[model samples]
Target: MGKVTLITGASRGIGYALALEMHMRGHHVIALARSEDKLQALKAECNDNRMECAVVDLGQPAQVDQFISALVDRGYTISHMINNAGALVNKPFGEISASELRHVYEVNVFSVFELIQKAMSVFADDIHVVNISSMGGFQGAQKFPGLSAYSSSKAAVASLTECLQEEFGEKGWSFNVLCLGAVQTEMLAEAFPGFKAPVNPSEMSTFIADFTEGAQKFIRGKVLPISSTTP
Candidate 1:
């Protein structure tokens, strides 16, 4: 059997492109996202049975755990786990609400932690775990005015990746964080309406696919910042 890759937020943007790229490389992709319609569209685009999808709200940890359990019961061993699902609440720091902050953390930080914990049980030997973060959250990256909640949540993700690497790297698991720069995607557009991102989602996805597929073996537990411009 081909290696199984689990990708969250796979219905669109970088996640969707990564799913396609990985599928083309002959891997079995399990794509999860909140939009059923988009997920179906992605599956249809695959034009093969190699891609599976689930419409899931990653903010709900219990539901995510149940889904992982089902995968385990089905005798699936995941070789790659991509925590690509994230939420952004781009508001001024002063205007951010408690609920908004909670939601962002729930989706970006807590859900990632939960998924990684559950996935650890079924990870194949030498598995790679990629947690998507942002350049804004990365140290010394250009800061934006309205991204406090989202950026902080991503920062937590980076920290978590580092900690998990220390705990799990000795056991053949590679944990890495990709602190991505602005990409031309819905999320980026929503956050910065008039700004044009230097790179496209497909371009970023290709780089990410290469890393997760094998290139990542050269380094473990590293936070990589990728952008067209130096930060």
Candidate 2:
């Protein structure tokens, strides 16, 4: 078996593309998502047994626990993790409900922490962790009108990446955040309908695949923003 990569939200968009790319490059990919049928399709499309998948809603602690239990039972060892799952709510600060804020953070930030805590059991030496964030969360960037909850949740992800790198770097682990700009995907279409994104999911996934494939030593602890303005 090749080095194992654990990728969240792997049923579609950038997550799906990344899973396929990593598998093509000979990594054993553990794809996690809420949609079992979609994940099964991804696995079949790969046409390789190297892709493993689990269906779980990352926002729920109970589901996360079950997923972890299964992972442990299988004795899977992980060399890299892509915390790609996220929840976005596009409500103005005053209009956003408390529950909405909580849900956003639950999936975007807390679930990542829980996954990392659980995956320590199988983490390889010199492990790399990539936390996906958004350029909307970039400190002092031009603020969008209705993204307070989503932006803050992603900001928290960036903060966790920095803190984790400092806490774990000496132990041969690295953590980084990809604070991505607009990418064309279903999520983007839902979040910003009719707005054309310069970068497609496949294009962005190729870049992310390189980072997860061990570009960490050079760029650890960084929150790199990526985008192309081309329409």
Candidate 3:
């Protein structure tokens, strides 16, 4: 069995591009997302036996557990896992509902936690887990309005990455957080209309894919800011 890289939110944007980039680099990719049609489109575009797509909604804990359990039963060993799926609620801090906040945290933070916990059974010896965060979540970065829930949830993810590293770094499994800046993703467009990001999804995904594959060599248990402009 070849080493497998699992990417969440792989139906579109950065996840989709990263899946393709990983495939080009000879990786067997397991792409997970909520959109079955979009995932199938990605699979068709890859046109490679190495690319596998699954419909997964990261907001649901039971679904995440089931997915990981299936991977474990299949004897799959994950060499790299990118927690690239995120949820955003673009509402004022005062107007954000309890359910909306919970949904944000559920997808951005809770899902990553559950997935990583369940995935431990199938982790390769040299596994690297990259948690994708946002520039708004980075400490001391320029803050923005209408993203209280989304930003705070991302902060939780970044902190969780550090905690995971501390607990597992001695085992030689690497964990890192990438606080990303503005990227031309559909999500971004939805969050901040009329804003043109500095880099497109393809460009940012190329950088992220390379870093995900190589960052463990030089750094682990660190949070790095990946951005050219603050949004």
Candidate 4:
């Protein structure tokens, strides 16, 4: 059977490309996002039931929890889980409200934790979790403006990925954090204006999707950086 893959933020950008690439690889993909319209368009583009769409907003974990429960009821076991949904904050730290920071964590870090918790409860031993992090989490952590919340949350996510890797991955499962550089996405556009996106979403997605699909072969429990700077 094809590997069952579920990707968050699947409406556009890297997520959309990842969904399409996974379906092309013969994996049964559950493309998730908040916009049902984009999901419909994604479904139309794929034209295969193997590429299904789930309306989920990661910031709302209760809804995602309910959706997971329903999938469990249907005996659907996800082989791969990609935590790709996130929020961006571009204002000064003082200007960024508490609620704004809270929601950033909610979507980027907290919801990932919740999803992993749910996945652990129901998924098989061979399941893999891939957390998509940012170069901002490591490099320019303090250099960028208005990145205090966004970067720190992703840094937390990177830490959580390591923790989860140590806990579950060392035993049997595969858990990884891929710290990606500037990709051609809306998020990148906001982070650094005028600098052209060094990476194409489709190319990035294809590389990362393949990496996610066969994580056990190359990596086990670690935070690896994928950047143009890397040889």
Whose lDDT is greatest here?
A: 3
Itemize residue pairs with steric clashes in candidate 1: none
Q: Model 4 off-target regions past 4 Å?
A: 139-142, 229-231
Across residues 85-198, which tens digit of lDDT does each residue of candidate 2 receive?
988887677999989889999999899998898778878888999999988777866667778888888888999889988888888888999888889988787678799887
lDDT of 4 at 50: 95
The best candidate in terms of TM-score: 3
Q: Give the TM-score of candidate 1.
A: 0.97
Structural similarity to truth (TM-score) of each candidate? 0.97, 0.95, 0.97, 0.94
| Better candidate by lDDT, 3 or 4 | 3
Task: Report every candidate's CA lDDT.
Answer: 0.89, 0.86, 0.91, 0.83
RMSD of 1: 1.2
Candidate with the larger lDDT of 2 and 3: 3
Candidate 3 residue pairs in backbone clash: none
lDDT by residue for model 4 over 9-94, one digit each (tens)?
99888999999998998889999999999999999998978988989887776787888898788788788888888788889988
Global local distance difference test of model 3 = 0.91
Which stretches of model 2 miss by more than 4 angstroms?
Answer: none
Candidate 2 backbone collisions, by pair = none
